[model samples]
Target: MRLGSVIKVKPEKLEEYKRLHRNVWPDVLKTIKACHISNYSIYYKDGFLFSYYEYKGNDYHQDMAKMAADPKTKKWWAVTDPCQSPIETRNEGEWWAAMEEVFHLD
Candidate 1:
């Protein structure tokens, strides 16, 4: 499955965020792969970040919960979350505003 989301990046934190993403921790990458996420990418434009990733797991929510529960992942978020400003359109408890895939051809 494919997933995508959008979030606002604070202007001041943009460069730092990019630098962090450039060399995400090895353990963190392993955790993400363990959660069945692949082809993950984040693009930036005008202070907005667009993220996309593919899920190979059957249980999406459960895997997400597991990812969220990981200690290292939690620590990672502590540093990254401060750089993001979730859009107003994001629902309660959502850090990234999920997007609808209007079209896809493969």
Candidate 2:
């Protein structure tokens, strides 16, 4: 399955956010793979950050919980979270607002 989400990057921290992602922690990457996510990518445009990734697991929620529980991932988030600003219209409990896949081909 494919998923997409969006969030705002604080203007002041945009560079730092980019820098952190440029060298994402190895353990965090491992945890993401372990959670069955792949082809993950984040893009920046007009102060907004968009993320896309493919999910290959049967239990999405369970896998997400596992990712959230990872210590290294937690530590990574602690450093990066401040660089992001969740959209006002984002769903409750969501840091990145989930996007609807209106169209797709192939």
Q: Which predicted model would earn the best TM-score?
A: 2
lDDT of each: 0.95, 0.98
Give a tens-digit lDDT track for model 1, residues 52-97.
9999998999999999999999999999999999999998889999
lDDT of 2 by residue, 1-106 (tens): 9999999999999999999999999999999999999999999999999999999999999999999999999999999999999999999999999999999897
Clash pairs of candidate 1? none
Q: Any idea what lDDT model 1 has?
A: 0.95
RMSD of 2: 0.5
How far off is residue 65 in model 2, in Å?
0.2
Model 2 residue 106 lDDT?
A: 77
Superposing all C-alpha atoms, what RMSD in Å does each candidate have to the true structure?
Answer: 0.6, 0.5
Output the number of the lDDT-best candidate.
2
